[model samples]
Target: MGIDLLTIHWIYLIFILLIIVFMICKKDTSLICILGIFVLGVVGTSDFSVAVMGVFNSFVFATEELMGTILIISVITGMSNILLISGINETMIYPFTKIIRTPSLAYWIIGILMMILSWFFWPSPAVALMGAVLLPIALKVGLPRIGVAMAMNLFGHGIALASDLIIQGAPKITADAAGIPVSDVVSASIPLNIVMGVVTTITAFYFLRKDMKNGTLFEEERAVEDIEDKDCIEKNKYKFSKGTRIFFAIVIPLFFAADIVIMYIKKLQGGDATALIGGTACFVLVMISVLTYREKGLEKITSHLIEGFQFGFKIFGAVIPIAAFFYLGDAAFGQIFGEVLPANSQGIVNDIGIALAKAVPINQGVAAITLTTVGAITGLDGSGFSGISLAGSIAKLFSMALGSGIATLTALGQIAAIWVGGGTIVPWAVIPVAAICGIDAFELARRNMKPVLIGLIVTTIVGMFLI
Candidate 1:
């Protein structure tokens, strides 16, 4: 079956290349993306007015598709914020502090908790809160501040943020772009994520131990007396009673645990799973606001929710335009423009994949490596997310050409992009963790580069076999 290419297809290809170049150069792509959308519209409609309207319509469609993700992240962040204010977070982390009698225990436990907390509330809030409570304990038990920062950055933003297992945020974006079910991406990512996580963490730990034992790590290092976050460290602001804080701390975990149980029993993944978590967080937020704020509970809940939504939009504002442009590569193209594509044209991306498959020499190894490289390049902008949609779209194209391995390719790109730019090895992205630990952000990134690269190499090879 021969597939014919159109002008729109060529236009799409050119813009994708341009966007990739922008990302590799660490340039902003919003204007470029908008221009791409408008040009695509102009080409499709051949009418300036309709094309302008199509740009606006595309934004709306992208927002609509992403609303579920936005809501869940916002509500969960709201819940975490409330937990911080009420001082319930202190109780939640207090238990882990007791078990860090050894340096190894301190390293692994802090990282594991960081990964779990990151899954629920994203990395920023977790780092801010956890660094306050656990940083001191970890340091006391012999872990250097840099090592502590590495654990948090790697596990929280690197491992958890990349996979986004329970929240399904990353998977949702990539899957939507790749034109596959979110569950398929999730399932495919599991083994790959585990391999990457294990290899990276263990290798990091080995180097950490060797460095610590050699005393070279502390050669010029000064002792950090305190962190910069005054509110988290010096201030003990608790609005609720100690007993009430303890109660909610226990109840909140139980509720989330129950949500996990329900997810397993009901087979809920992706949006369904997200709905359960979001609903639970909402109830917990309302309940705590009422109990702690009493008469002001209603107003306070609104404030907290506003804060959460602000964080959500701040993180996703750039994502919307990029997503809008990519959505056009899928079915949204027809719905947005009312059949602008030619008859017998299997969607633009699908056709490209088929066309390229016939035109190029593609195998599992080449596809796997290409995805890793593309994913890494996309992540160069420091958002990690700014380019995953591109990775997904490329995965879809390559999958068609190779006749298999879309999920593997998608997961590989996701891991590479995120580990590099999702606050792990990127100098700017590592600042939050570095500040919390009082270490240089660039140094932290340098330390992380070796382990992350080693992990990516091993995982890419593993993906080759699976594909």
Candidate 2:
């Protein structure tokens, strides 16, 4: 049975294209997504009320699909918050500061440390942890604030969050949407992540060195003395018994390091890896909270949990609606619509892929470029992980059309989405880095654009070869 082009929901295609256009214009697509769902529902059911109901249902569907990711990020964040308040975060990074003797070393060391920490605690919290402790050191040692921001943004958000190997949140969303195992996406992303990380960082560093030599990279004249004094006082206020801080600082890394080992030895890929990490994070949160706030531990735990959920849902709020619209392009369409789609229905994205496969000449190169573009567009909402499900769905569609490399294509799209919106090149997304570094977010984004775009292009071409 062939897909009859006439039977396809051409309006679905139009909605997707409209979304891309909206993204290109740097506008939020949440309202546009809801409108798409309404249009698609009305087209499918011809009932305005049913269509309205479908809108709510689609959100419910997306929440259900993304709950695991949301929960994992929340738990990890709560754990991170505990570490922060307990002063364990500072303890963890203290030793690393010893190695940063030069401006160049400060840039790379901070970046590497941020990458490692972000892999476990995520970039947002990691930024706070490292920035508070190391940013001053970097500044004093002659690394410009913009250079520091570039390093943190590139390594933490760009490399770490983009690939997101240890936590596996990004890949889980992508793999689920692509109907593949998380390991495949992880494995495929390794090469792409390396290419992007190495190229972007090295290129950015070279430019940074040139600017510094040309005397264009002047240090921002802020109250460094006051900030350092205040930070020292703050650290003193949170001083756990040296033993407690030392104990947790060691235990935390050991626990996560063991999780990595267990994942490798036990082959606990995908959800299992994420479950291990989340469970460990929760355990650490409770352990640390009880030890530090013993009398008020229970109440404190609740507050920590509330903050975690707030952070997680805050990011997910914009995501769920967009995901809802894209979920319509997959098998979930039937459930979202509350009606049985046609038997053998390939869904909207897949249908488009099939139509493209039949109508146009597409190869690995075209498919790579298309998925990368789609991923980048979905990323315009500025929550990097939010758009991954669509990328995964499109990867699956394109893979089905091409008959191979589902994982590779999915990974490619994942990189694109995260790199663009994971807080690297996107202005709004880079605000945290910019604000922390006291630089303009747009300037940071401008500094990042060349390296990230070049990295993406190089990675895409390399991905074409791999695929």
Candidate 3:
């Protein structure tokens, strides 16, 4: 059965399209997102005051949802800053520098390592940890920070997350909704994942090399690129023994390595894993501050933490408005603004996905395309996982009617969802990477767009044949 699309749904869709157009035109979408939220508020409640308040509440909602990631990034950045000020980061990255002597080596090495770690710890936490270690090495080897970001994002969130073999979170959701075994989805995803990962990463690399060669890639917008750019030692203002530097360098990785072990044995994923890493970063930051600064440690630790948070909030401040508006298109709308969706509706984005699926006829080719389109639409909510069940449900309907290709269709939908919303093309979704790389999130998203779009098209066509 097809669900009725409400006025709010149309409003949300129009704004989403507008946001995409604005993004393509390289315009900031914060005002557009704020207007979208206010319009949603007005359409839902029919009250001017409530509409204005909705924008504020939506910001609060996005912050609450994003707090964990923000905290982790802050502490990590704080720890990074202290390491920079103390000169520990140079020692920490010395080994990696030997191995990553060239830009090509740096790109592939960081990417592969990120993929392996993300398979275990998931992308968000893994990135926080990996960026602290590998970023300097990549930067030193002439790989741009955006290049490093692209490598990690592509290999981690785009590939490992889409496949999700270790965690099985994404496939489990889609498999259950599609009425298939998780193994079926996993098995079907292997080839498609390889295609998407290889094609997208290679395509992205090609552009990176071309622009870098032509001197077109820009990183100069920032006052400083990263930790390494500044004098590694402010020796006049701060002093630490070489032993202390070496000690923390060893301790830092050991502690984070222990975190990975604990995560493995405990079967922690998502927020739990993120909390584990964040807590470790906090502990390390305190230890370094106290041990390095001695009498002034108490005061210095708070200052370092303040700097970290300032940096985290700075990046996220620009993002909350956009994230707030997208969160409304998902289950968060009811929680934030009250139960205003129509009786037959399945939330705003889900309704749109179902409507799109219903408008199409059932066949193998149409099924593949519809599943991909539905998955991408659902992913527009930007959680990546939010509306995938709808994709699975629609895939099941088409596959059963066509009498084959359920697994292929299901996997196809999962890929499209994660690729678009997990961390690739969505600017807000890729904000953490942009923050870490110190690049504009919109520009990062734009760099990712062409390669990802091309990869999706090729992968969807491949799935059609498999179906």
Candidate 4:
């Protein structure tokens, strides 16, 4: 495992170049990241046999590590879809619109509401709920599709998912790697989340205002885009009962409450948080199916599970290749791949981080800003969490080389990645929002571009000075 300086890692450089060029050419970041990993393995070993094994090994480890979390997310998401189809989700959101009276209020209200729901239930479920009920009201009140999408993105994915204060998934993952307390990560992330949230939200507002002033578009018409009920066929498939609605109203909260209580009890005894949540979600999935389809319990349960798996695989598959590439940088994964290399080996991503750390001599404050920018760039792939470990690793390197504040730098990077890559500012990420609002995802993204960009810049600057 001796570090070798003499051997030129040409393949590594070429692979990274290809990825950058592809990204520049507007190729999918997921594909480029995957190819980066494949090249990393092939170059590192110079043996097809070993390279093939490395790829498989990396995937196995990555899949195993992410499996529980992914499955939990999928099942809960499917349950949310069920809730929407049953109109329970809409009923839950119906009252909020009554309190929200104006476009501005709608924006903040929707944003904050999504943040709250996503904190416990996650963004995917939160999206379904918000889209079904709150969206229609917001649309009715002249909240633009861009505005609604921005609100959901900021609250659900950006603030809620990034902080992960309740679910603790994102923090747990980062804290485990950093060897820090989950509480520390959570505490640090809260303020950073606020910075990003405020910046993104305000930026979105600014863009909206600019467009409104220019008369380029009308805010009222944003939500007036075609409302296709094709996706709502499920609404007709299942009849909603007042009883069932009440049942769901009680059961959904109860299930989540039970999850929290169980998680707390387990944590008191130092148990696994992810496993607790995952197991609870699985149970909820099963119970919901039984309660909803009491007559054909087994068949209906199988159907729900199938649907859950479909969603799980769709999310997981989209990023598996990306994860595979990032996996190469972690020592745990390197060991799994049986790569007898030092942790600091010049893999494409690592090399870039190391080179930046060495060449850019700067103060801790500026270092933090630089790190955050790098994190944001990496997040362009649209999976915020995918880049956390990389950001963490890079922050550590920068801290060592440039005397940057380690915790502060890491926090900055984490926020940057989760905010941008987590889905708030990206068009590809607004798919569910577009699907629900009956608008083009590209247009939603375009509308968001200015505000999100401004917010990210503001947040990064603030993080540097304050963090």
Candidate 5:
């Protein structure tokens, strides 16, 4: 019953390495992934026609696996859009701006609020919400617009997404790929998340403070001019009662918070937690539309839903093919291609991991570092969640070889992926934050690089101890 390491699938190893190289060159991997599927299919089925068919089937399989995540994100986005249109999103954060009267306070308060909102509504929508309401206030209090962008990018995309505690989208992907319970991933991520969040945020703030004291925190002249005459006031004022704004502003958070409570009490972990969040978002979307638009709400609801789906699928389009290639390295290969792999078959990634363990003698430190590097490399495509399944699969393989700490390794990889590609360090990924604050995305990413890198190093070290 011994597996033949020598007879292992070399194509998988080749394609995986190809993917890493492609990502490092800052190129799209979707076409590369499709090529991987075709080659794997040809080899697996020993037929060229089946291989061609496999390309389409692999995408289908990837979509089926990812449908829940896509739906939840879309629905949440719809809820957020409706809130914005109804003015509830602004009302939610209006009170917090009163506490930020100084630059020092502005940094922490804006960062904290961004993190909290990102956890519930996700980083993209949360950035739009916080940016419009908090940016002008931060600027008025003498915090530069770049400072506002940094706080939003780091806290919302970096910390909140790296942890992903409330919605569980990131953890769900990692956990499923690792073939473990979602709770394990969530539980393991908490400590690493805290370390990364605290270290990065504090380090970033320290630098910002130094820059301010040295008079080096000057805004880009063009950006300053652009927003100088502009205020953060909502452009499309609605006649909706103030009570409606306050009502939803309070109710939405309470509803999602209650979902978290129920999840914990009922031990509703994986798809169940996703279902709760998605269902709640849909209900809120309906309520907000009906209350705000009345009869017109019916038509408005459709438009919101359409926009939500558009955004969700746009992200998914980049992710699915990449995921398809990784899925071929797992049990899903059997289901996807209509063939049962050999009884003793080890999926390609696991096989490569085992070979690595044997050839290189990987200890926990080495394993942790490798996972982090892989995660960071996969993140080069600028979509943080896209490459997480690869991280999870590799973590599982390494854990099997090392005999412990699956969750910790998975969490470390998750944190690295999200922080780098989620928004903080990736130029393209930081667009939402940068655009909202009217700063340059590259500049925002450059500002975030040092703090995020240091945090990753510290977090990896902490992960070693935990493991």
Candidate 6:
């Protein structure tokens, strides 16, 4: 497991430099990752032939690993997009406006709704739906666009997508790496998620309320200020056919409940649960598209799939290279690249990580914090999945080296990765919500920064104890 010092120093230096440049310049991570792979491959293999293959191999591995998640995410998003065009998303939220009579109530109400929908449908689509429907109502009732964006980001992206309780994708990643059941990861993560969610939400509310009070100077004018998304309001006036409403309302929940029950009964965990969820999502996607489109189902099906792929690729294209570099820190992929280098040299990337851990000798507390910090940083690239992949790999490496619970470590890492990069803390991730609400993404992220940082710190501490 020991790495040659000569290779370690050079590889480590190069990785650090690339990372610094990436952070400072805000360049595309994919290019940075490709460069890392090429450099590492050349150094490791010392053969032009192997170095060339290494680049192709990096992309191949990323495609192989992420293709399914990307497909499911894209298709589901596309389906939701179709639902939006049909005004089903608006129909779904109209009822909430009545119950949520005030701005405060709207904040929590939208947060919970976004959380639920996000768990099933994901944040990208959920945000679109929420933005199209709830945002105007929220603003009308005195909720700032910033507040609306913050709620969607925290609830949909941070709480729901991070947990991915219904979909099981995030849990599967951690569970697979830990060689544990998905159920165990799910069960453990729920409590952690609740703690994180409540703390973050309350903290956010406090800050938001104060801002609202201070900004009261323009209360009358702002109150009259229309969000200009009059088109969404017009769309909501259309009534959903009773059958469509009744069918989806009952069917969606029932499908998810069945999955939960089946998973519990079978004690299914990891890939089993993920396959079950993925399979169910695909079935539902097909059935729903068929039911809505009817005789034209074939073409509609193709359209939905195409939409899904476009959305998925848009997300994946941005994050894949970062994943490739992080994979270097793992023995599995690292060993593949390491073989290309000096025959006698050990995997430099893996070795350097271990050596640094040993050299600094961080305690479990500090290690947890470090892991969380690293996950948050990677999320800056804006695709939560890439950050999760990188964080999971790091967790596996550290857990093995430290003889800790990989499941716990991976879950902790997943939380940090998603919460930060998943959308709340990143301007790019908040763009949809911001654009839809006619607000600024940077301001949205800045508004969310404090709550998210606090939540991360608290969660990291809790993870140390739980793990």
The alpha-carbon RMSD values of the candidates against the true structure, listed in the order shown, are 2.2, 2.5, 7.5, 4.1, 2.9, 3.8
- What is each predicted model's overall lDDT from 0 to 1? 0.87, 0.85, 0.76, 0.66, 0.83, 0.71
Per-residue lDDT tens digits for candidate 3, residues 235-291, read 326656778778877877788789879988997655676678778878888988887
TM-score preference between candidates 2 and 4, better one: 2
Q: 1-467 in candidate 2: lDDT tens per residue?
A: 33333333677778767877887888888888899999888777767998899999999988998888899899999988878878898899999888887789999999999999999888998887777888888887889999999999999999999889888889888887887888999999999999989999999999999999999888553424322322365346555887889888998899999999998899897778889999999999998888777788898888888989999999888788878887888777788765545666667677777777788777999989988888888787788877788788879878877888899999999999999999998899999888777789999999999998899899999999888
In candidate 1, stretches whose alpha carbon ends up further than 4 angstroms from where it belongs are 1-5, 219-237
Candidate 1 contains a number of clashing pairs equal to 0
TM-score of 1: 0.96
State candidate 4's TM-score.
0.82
**Candidate 2: regions farther than 4 A off:** 1-8, 219-238
Per-residue lDDT for 307-348 in model 6, tens only? 788878987776566655665554435545654335444444
Scanning candidate 2 in windows of ten residues, the lowest lDDT window is: 221-230
Error (Å) of candidate 1 at residue 326 is 1.0
Weakest 10 consecutive residues of candidate 3 by summed lDDT: 220-229
Question: Model 2: number of clashes?
Answer: 0
TM-score, candidate number 2:
0.94
**Which segments of model 4 are wrong by more than 4 Å?**
1-21, 29-47, 168-184, 206-231, 261-271, 337-339, 342-362, 402-404, 465-467
Model 2 accuracy (lDDT, Cα): 0.85
lDDT against true structure, model 3:
0.76
Candidate 5, residues 209-233: lDDT per residue as tens digits? 8998899987333323223212133
Which pairs clash in the backbone of model 1? none
